[model samples]
Each structure stands twice: as C-alpha cells, then as structure tokens.
Target: MKETVPLSVTESSEAEALFHFETGAPEAVRAALGLNATRIGDVVAVSMRNDPTRYWSKALGFGRTAAVTGELIAEVCAFYRAEGTPLAVLQLVASVLPEDWAEIRAREGITAGSSWVKLVAEVDEVVARAGAPDRRPMDGLRVAPVEPGDAGRWASVMMRAFGMPEEHYSGMAAATVTQPDWYPQAAWLGEELVGSATVYRFGETAQLFGAAVLPEARNRGGQTGLLVARARTAGELGCRLLVSETGAETDGGHNSSLHNMLRLGFRVAYERQNWVWQPAG
Candidate 1:
C-alpha cells in the first residue's frame, strides 16, 4: 500500500480518464454512435446511442465533490432518460457511498451490480515489480508504442480479447491513439499483435485502461510487459501515480485481471460499486 491516496484524487483521476476516452471519438464517429455526455453537479455521465452496453454509458465519480443525495441521483437518471439511453451504471467511491444508498437505490429502481476494485501504484514500485523474473516471461514478447496507422489494429486486438463487439467501441478506442496526452501500446508476440494497453495522463496521474490480451496469448507475460510499458511511458511523461480498476473478486468467482494487477504492486485503493438503473414501470 503506497501511502493512501485521497478519494477525491482517485475520483478526479478516474472520472477524467474515462470521460476523455468515452467521448473522444471523431466527429463522424460520434454522430454514428450518438456519443454524448453531460455533467450533473460535478458528476460526468456519458451515453452511446448505438451501443447498448452500459459500460460505456455510465455516470462516474459522483458524490465525491458533494453529498450523494437522492436529488443528485434523480438528475443523473434524468440525463440518461432524456438521452434515451435505456440503462445506466452509476459509480460512487465506496468510501463516499451515502449512508442511505440502499434506500436511494431502491427508490430509484437501481439494483446492486458488480463492484470494481480500484488500484494505484507508484511508478518506481511498478518498475521494480516489472523487473521480477516471474513478471517478465522470456517468451518472444515485445511491447511497443502503437503507430498512427496501427490504431485500428490495436483497438481490434483489445476488444477481441474481451470478446466485445468491435463495431461498437473499436473506432472510439482507436481514436485515443491520437488524443493528446494519451499513450497507447500494442503487445506483439513475435510477428502477431496479441494484446493492447494504454496510459491516459491527466495532471500528475496516469490512468491504466483498455489492457487486454487475446485468448491465444494468455499467461505469456504479455500483460505484465504491457503494464511495464505503460508505467514507464507514464513516468517519462512526469506522472507520479498510476490508477486502474477491475471487477472485484466475489465468492465462488475470481477475476484474473484483479490478481494480475495486485501482483504488479497495484494496491486496492477502495472497492467501488456499480449501481444499475432502469426506468420505473
């Protein structure tokens, strides 16, 4: 555990990271996907008209700048409703989840959803972790910066790794390759592009997002290699901290991503809930 980071810092780092990625699509792609976003109080919520998945259509980092009040939640729901986005995920830092969250969620037709374990690491600690023999498999793995022309290929490999439909999110993911302060990388196992990772730098923090490896490329040190790649990139850019999150481990279930992150010196800052909301009947 690196000295604990303030929840407000985690909140801002994460909120800006995801917001920039989700709404960073090109003009035509934005129109094609109906990508849009708005702020409710200090909370930023985004919606995708074409993609039905709630992951990209979510309100995050709320209640950190202010109290988690029912009115605030109502405004959040209204934003989604007006956009006609059928479902939404609301993420509030567990440490800041209002005391009456249960009642608020119940009244708003929100239900419990998966929790995410937020993690952070100092750049130096991660560089040390990456030097571990176990983390640096001797397989023919190499991580390199994604070229301008390779954005599509980079995004394709990442989405494929997660079994996501490429048509919905790949274009936007690729767009990040050119976004300022965004560093995207692809992992190559010999001649084939096997995985992808990215570091989104904001202020003094670098956010780790979109890291994944294909099924055929698993357990070969590609991910750890990618982590090292991004960590170094962030450090070179003068970032002091790296932030990331993955699904929390639950009873009878496990999240390999979470395990991998923990092994790389990323400590759990907190567990944040995903509150699901749908229109009332």
Candidate 2:
C-alpha cells in the first residue's frame, strides 16, 4: 500500500465535486425531464419522479462541509417526502462536520447508513497499469462497450450479478442508456455475459461505478479486465482523473474491489457517510 496523507482542502473539494457529478448524473437526467431536482449550496436533492429506488431519490452533498445548515437538510428531506419518496438518503462527502452529523441524527425518521471511502487515481497512471507490456488479456474473456441493442442483456447480467430485482435494474438500464455520455460496458465469455461496468464523465474527471461480476466468473480476471477497459475508455475520452468509491475497509475480506483499485494505483482520497430516512410506523 502507498503511504497515505491527509486530504488537503483542494483535494477534498475536487473529490466532493466528483461525488456530486457522479451521484447526481442520473438524477440530473431525470431533472432535465422535469423531475424535482433542486440545489441548495453544494447539495442536490433529487426526488422519486420515475424510479423509486432509494439511490435515485435522495440528497447528495459535495465538498467538505457540503451541508452546513440544518435548514438545508430539513428542506431537502421535506421536498423528497412531499414528492412521495419513502426513503431519503443523504450521501455526503468526507468534509461534513460533526455538527452536521448531529443535526442529521436529530432529524425524524433518519438513520445512519454505511460509510464509504472515495478512491481516486490519475488517468495516466491507471492507463499505464492497465496497459503493462507483460499483462496479457485473459483467455476466453472479451469486453466491449454495449451497443444500443445490448441493453436487455446488459440489464439481465447486472441484475443477476448484483441480486437486484428485474423491475429495478431493467428500468434503470433502459433509462441509463439514453443518458448523455453514459458509457455502459459488458464482459462476456463464450457468448455468456459475465460482468458489467459504467463510466460517467464530468469535465476532466471520469467516475466509475456499477461494476458487477457473476459468481461463476469470480476467480477469473473478468473484474480486472472490466476495470482496465473502463479506465482506458475514460482516458480515450480525454479525462485526466478517475474516481470511484467502495465500501470502507471494515469486514476483513469483503472489500476485494478496494484491493483491486489499489493495485490499479487508486488511492483512498477521503470518506463519505450515508444517512438514510425511512418513514416511521
């Protein structure tokens, strides 16, 4: 592991911006279609206009101290409730202060969720690691960007890989392919789809997410291939920074993706806390 340093102010701000751009992209698409997405400070609150997934209907805070005022949090939560969101999630960048956490805990119907570490790497470095001269592509595995017709298969593989419901991932895949600059890629082995990944570009930064691999393909190099393919594509698009997040290092061996990312030169830049609100009986 590389030596770690505390997050500087500029690094914190940039990471927060990437977080908002990445988490807010889908909601931003929904908002462009007249859904309820409003900005308060560096926070963006998106409601369940179409998809009712908690991931789709929540408030996203960017930067250090993204949500400083209790009033901002209350208003955003109220907006989601008014829009019929059963559960509201507040995902804040590592810069959030203790007072903000205290105010959030005081809110009715809210509970703390998982904390995640945001990882970042220079696109050049990832590209180099991915394109090492001795690194040969895994035999019997092929990866490529999804065509428009691959949406159904892509959705099926994603749902199965993540154990998500068909209804949820199907609709998500349908809507996602139509978003601007959303690149969904899939990996296959002898015509069987085994894994999937996605990259969303914001300015010079490319945020990677939604990487899923089937259980049968776990021991193989499918996951690493998918990561390298996505990173290369992002670099080809002129992005300089590659940002991603994974569950923090808590359970000893549960965060293999974090290990994979570190091997690809990604460093833990900061952490984010998740606060969730579900209506009481």
Candidate 3:
C-alpha cells in the first residue's frame, strides 16, 4: 500500500471553489435553476434563486488569496441581495478570519451559525478501512458511476431522497452529471434506484460533494455502498485523499452522516463555524 500524503487547506479550498464554479458552464440547468457561481477574488459566492429552500446560497473559501476586508464582505452580501437570496452562509476556515471580522460582520447583518465538520481520508486509509476498492453488487444493491441516460433518474432519486420535490433541483442535480470533471454515483436495488452520490476530481483530491439514500433504503447500508463506490473510483484514479463535510454534532443533535463518514475512515480535518447573513428590509 502506498503511504498517505499531506493535503493542504489551500488545495482543498481551491478544489471546492472550482466545484462550486462548475455550474456556470452548464447552460442547460443554469437557466433552469437560476444558479450563479461568482468569484470575488479567491472567494466563491454561489446562489440559486429558484430554490425555495435557500440552502444553496453561500460564500466560501474566502481570505486565501487576500485578507477578507470589510469591502469584500460587503461585495459578497450585495451579490446575494441582488440574487434575491434570503440567506447566505459566509464560510471560511477559522484560521484565516481577519482581526476585524466582528466589526465587518456587525456592519453587514452577519450572524453566527452552527459549524460544519470537514473530513478527510487518505486513499490508503480508505482502502484498508472500507475494504479493497470494489463496486460489485453487494447484498441486494449494486453501485456504479452514473451513465448518461441515467442522469435524470439519478437526479430524481437525489432530489426525492433529500425531500426536495421541486423540479428545478432535479434539473440542477442532473446537470452535474454532464460535467466532465464530476463523477456521480448511484446505487441500485436490483432494477430500482435507491441512492445517489457525487464526487468531483481536481488534481490529486476527490471531493465527495453530496450523497443521500431514499427513505425506503435507510438502514440498508446504502450510504456505505456509496462510500465504497467513491473510494474505489478514487483509488483507481490515484487520488491521494477524499474530502467531505457534514453538519457537526451539536447541542445533542446527532448527525448520522457524520457517523457514517467516521466509520468509513474519514477524520475531522477541522470544525468551521458558519456565518449567516440575513439582509434587512
């Protein structure tokens, strides 16, 4: 087994920004979702005006290229305001917060929010902990990279699994499969699709962007299967590490997703508190 290597925060942030920016080139779903991924210097500010949930609007990976000045924060807020986003989660690693963030945040209507636990697993660690890279059918489920014709079905399962019935979300999810840099995976219970997951490749790292299982498939190991499928692909492609994040276990609120990732060998790289902005009328 090859020894694990280092994964710098800079590379991980850059890769995440690229993944967020990926939606811009896919015009088909871009118009359908009213999605925009804007970059103010190194910061990536993304928004989806068509989704009522408003969870899609956030600015992340800021302050790497330069200090996050008050003006830069204002620019991000203005972008969200113009996009009609109800809220924006402004996220960055805690290590990079400027000394004057409190002043800037107070002036911009920003409020503190819960944190997300970023996780990382070396390829060798995954191989050892999750078993050898294998995507063959296990139990009653089979996992594989999404096929072109199956993108719509993948989107359907993804949106439904996430409890989102909005048609545009399916459109947004499906459009990601068409991107050359993204690797979307799906698990099938015989002929029926039960789960979906996606990984984005940027250089030596693979970002596990999203994954979910149908309610009916819960407790059936579908989540583990998705992890296995992604690990197998990342292994074959020489990816040094797999990166992902889930809502932190907070205030007695247990997160099953975090448990799944830890059980599969991913370790917490850091806990980053999210800053939320709600523009005042």
Candidate 4:
C-alpha cells in the first residue's frame, strides 16, 4: 500500500513542488500569483497563489481575512489588484477551501453598486465508466485520434466551448500535444468536429481536462460521449480512475448541464469555491 503523508503547514521547497505538480500551473504563474509554501505538519500545503496579502492575512488573522463573511470578497479583490485586471473580467478557478471564503470576501469589500461578485461552486468527480472500443457499433458519432497538425483547430473548438480566451486554449493544446503520455482526441458528428477532451496520466490516475463542446453542437451527446471515450482510453493505458471538474452552481445555462453528468453516475467527490476580490477604488 502507498504510504499516507501527514498534512503540514510550513514553508518548504517540497511544498512548492507539490503545489506545482498538483495544479499544473506554470511556475512563473505561481510566482506571479504569490503562492506561499506552508507545511501542515509533515505534508506540505501551498496557499492559493492569487493573492499574497490574503495568504498572510488568513495565516495571521488580520485585514480582510479577519472577517468571517468577507474572505471570498477579500481574496478576489486582492487577485484583481495584483493582476491589474478589472474585477468583472477576471475568471477564477475554484479550490477546496471553505474556511477562507469569508476572509476572501472581506478583502474584496464588495458593495451593492461598484461590482458584482458571484460565488460559483464546482463539482469535482471521477469518471466511473469506460468508453466502447467497438466504434463500428455506435452510429453517427465518430471518435478519431487527434493528429499533431490538428492542434490549432482543436484549440479553437476548446476556446469556444469553455468561453476562454484564445491564448489559454492555444497554450494548453501546445503543451498537451508535446507530452508523450498525453492522449487527445476530437469527437465528430457526421463531418463536423463538435467536442474534444484530453487525458493526462499521473501515476495510477488519469485526469480528464479540456473537455468542451461547441455551443451549436451541445446536447447532442458530444460532451458526454467524449468523456466516455477519454475514460476508455485512460483505462486502456492502465489508469485506474478518470477525474474531471464540473460546475455545481445552477445560475447559468452552462451549469444546468452539470445535472446530466450527475445523472450519468458521476458522484460529487467535493465542491470547491472560487473567491474573488478587487482593489478599493
């Protein structure tokens, strides 16, 4: 059996390594976000890199982090200030830290008129099913191995599907394509490419990332089908589990589809919240 390491909250190089390995975010990005290394005990845990002030505040109990209802607000505020971006335009990826939410909100100082802060919860789950290898049996849907030259087109589809900027999609596609163990593929409906997903192998588990379906092609089972295909491919490569992140909030049309994934047998492993904060004007 694999030995379980105890969680520690200390500043250690090992903490930095674990943070980067788990998040897959660039080291420069980590530094830019001001990720601080903390050791919980024997295990290293890295604080969210997006805001240094909040990190210190939460760790020390002062500033925005002092308030129970304002942590999320504070964190978002600090993030925008550090990045020099408008609060409304920033997109935050959710992480599993509920105790810090209030401190984050207090830091942001969200008001009734200045800016809108939305608390989005994402459902994290693992794929329990595998894809069918007998492609000839399935009708109308064609799952093909993505070619090296098709990276650009695949990136385009991903950008549109996730509502992300072109740079992020392009960068991820380029990085994924060059990895020997990374498996990427596209889902075609008739002759049109509708969805795409990638599997990244990490030890005994494989993570499903970049799953997206074009707006015009959703609800035709494209996203779901692609997930199954990716899972099957991961299983074939000796991965025991496949995991993906989905939204839990239902305020938007996009989040409504999360119900479908849950109905398809994906259980919620945990819920993560994205905290936002903007500088005082």
Kindly list the per-residue Cα lDDT of model 3 for residues 73-176, writing each as its tens digit.
88999998998877878887787788898898888999999888888888677767676445333567778889989989998998888888647677667877
Instruction: Give Cα distance to truth, residue 245, candidate 1, Å.
Output: 0.3
- Please give the range of 10 consecutive residues that has the lowest summed lDDT in model 4: 5-14
Local accuracy by lDDT, each model: 0.84, 0.69, 0.77, 0.48
Q: Candidate 2, residues 231-253: lDDT per residue as tens digits?
A: 89888999887878788877555
Q: Which segments of model 4 are wrong by more than 4 Å? A: 1-105, 108-139, 165-168, 249-257
Model 2 residue 33 CA deviation (Å) reads: 15
Which scores greater on lDDT, model 2 or model 4?
2
TM-score against truth, every candidate: 0.94, 0.81, 0.89, 0.56
Pairs with backbone N, CA or C atoms under 3 Å apart (clashes), candidate 3:
none
> Which model is ahead, 3 or 4, in terms of lDDT?
3
TM-score order of candidates, top first:
1, 3, 2, 4
Q: Candidate 1 clash total? A: 0
Q: What is the full ranking by lDDT, best candidate first? A: 1, 3, 2, 4
Worst 10 residues of 1 by lDDT: 132-141
TM-score of 4: 0.56
- C-alpha displacement of 273 in model 1, angstroms? 1.1
lDDT of 2 at 20: 42
CA lDDT for candidate 4: 0.48
lDDT of 1 by residue, 1-281 (tens): 24888877777777888889988888777887788998778798988766755567889877666877888988898888888777888988766777888888888889988888889989888888888766547378888999999899899998899888888578889999999989998999888899999988988899998999998888787877888899999889999999998888889998888877778888988888888888877
